[model samples]
Target: MKAMVYRGPYKVRVEEKDMPAIEHPNDAIVKVQRAAICGSDLHLYHGMMPGTRVGMTFGHEFIGVVEQVGPSVQNLKPGDRVMVPFNVYCGSCYFCARGLYSNCHNVNPNATAVGGIYGYSHTCGGYDGGQAEFVRVPFADVGPSIIPDGIDDDDALLMTDALATGYFGAQLGDIVEGDTVAVFGAGPVGLFAAKSAWLMGAGRVIVIDHLEYRLEKARSFAHAETVNFAEHDDVVVHMKKTTDYLGADVAIDAVGAEADGNFLQHVTGAKLKLQGGSPVALNWAIDSVRKGGTISVMGAYGPIFSAVKFGDAVNKGLTLRMNQCPVKRQWPRLFEHIRNGYLKPSDIITHRIPLEHIAEGYHIFSAKLDNCIKPVIVPNAG
Candidate 1:
């Protein structure tokens, strides 16, 4: 099997590797069909995530055909086509029973905050991801669902992570009818978040980014207003002014870790690794929302200190909600939306690369070249 192997920071290449076999009674081996390079993957690629070791494959969003399943895996068979959520967890845990699958206590031995995630790092349970021809899925019966007949494979792939996380972000906002919502970042998650806000009855949606191409995508695909943070002297002030000086009813920070607005913050957080992640976008969210409004955080950040405005949030009585998304929890409603033509997750895909050229795919996406919004990997391309 060929898998993308992480070399040091800013380096990755395809290399032949041993195929994964079922190691647990509840495990399954999946032959990956379509896998996506998520925005969060860049964190591991750039050495922003600690414990991302060399020789580990990095990918979480994938749909595949089951090659083999253990005897205990009753819901899935050898021939089933399924979309596996990014989370790896046991079904009967206390957190899983409460629909907090991302925080399942039985999976990760390293930490209690985040459950096992495919290919994230040792901090995330050291589970290898699906960025290759085959991957091992633990607790297969609980995490994977057969792709329905009408859902496109690409759409199903996105549902594994990006699409589901975006919708979950919007749900955390608790948007009331006629409320104005502001979303920071225009990546796949942010674009989907902006689009999902409209479905939740937001009267207006605005997407903020520094890239013109992504802002253009947000305007056309999400049908939301756009703001280039680079063009403004103070983006939070601009957000406040746009929302009639009281600030938006809700604000979402979809840019995590690598947010680039303040020079010092990016240097200390992203370059020097002094802080867990840059809090520029999150601070902007806190400042851009109204005093009593809600702020939803869907961005990926490391488990460390960040210079967020916690005091200000308390002063303003803001409701701060954040967590790693419980991907399977959003599937039922998302299936209906995709079938009714209300949402098309595949429309955000801008590049598709063969598994052989995954290094180049990561480069293009990391560099933001070719106006790339999303890149899909084809493990068995002809």
Candidate 2:
């Protein structure tokens, strides 16, 4: 099998690797049909995420066909199409029982707090990822959602991560009918966040980003109102004006570490004075949201922390929710939405490339070229 292996920072190589097999009674082996690069994967590429070992597989967003399943895996079988959740959780854990799949107590012994993630790092359990011809899915019954007949693999792929995260963000932010929502960033997750906000009955969905191309894509594809932060003299002012000076009822920081404040020099005027939040987009979203509003952060963050105005966060009585998405809790709902016509997450996918050309895909996506939103990699291409 040929798998994309993480060699080092800004380095990934397609290398021949052993094929995966059913490792546990509850496990299953999947032949990957489609996989996509995620913004969280960028954290690994840039060396910001810790514990990523050399030769480890590097993808978590994928949908595929089940090639084999262990005896205990009764619900799924050979030839079943499935989407694997990015977070691997034991369904029987204390946290999992409470619907907190991201904080499952039975996985990732090395995780600083709780929960585990696929292909994230050693700290999240050194499980090989699905960025290859095949992968072994532990806890298959709990992690792999069977794709319904007639659904395209590309469409189902979003359920693996981005769609679930977007839905989770909306759920955590307490987005209700008639609420105005502002989402920071226009990446795949951000786009979905905006879309989810609308589906969950938001009165208005405003997406903010520096890139005109992404904002445009969000507007056209997701029907979101976009704000081009790069063109605005004051983002908060622009947002306030858009929301009639009350600011948004709910704000989501989807850009995480990639925001302007992280690269301090990129920000101008008042933004320069702040130390920038650990996940900089959080601060940006916090400032842009109305008082007493809720802020949901679904962006990836590393161990190294940054500073934020704690006093302001407290003073405004803002409700801050942050962390990796609890895929187990959200996947079923997203899957149901996909099964119906309620959510079209596939609209965010802008490029499709063969696995052999993954390096090219990475280059173009990492450079944000050609208005790339999401790039899906087909592993068995000729």
Number of the top lDDT candidate: 1
Question: Judged by lDDT against the true structure, how good is candidate 1?
Answer: 0.92
Candidate 1 Cα misplacement greater than 4 A, ranges: 261-264, 304-306
- In the predicted model 1, the residue pairs found to clash are none
- Give me the candidate number with maximum TM-score: 1
Model 2 misplaced stretches (Cα beyond 4 Å): 262-278
Which run of 10 residues does model 1 get worst, by summed lDDT? 261-270
lDDT of each structure?
0.92, 0.81
Q: Each model's TM-score, in the order given?
A: 0.98, 0.92
Tens digits of per-residue lDDT for model 1, 288-349: 99999999998998854656789999999999999999999999999999999999999999
> How well does candidate 1 score on lDDT at residue 80?
95
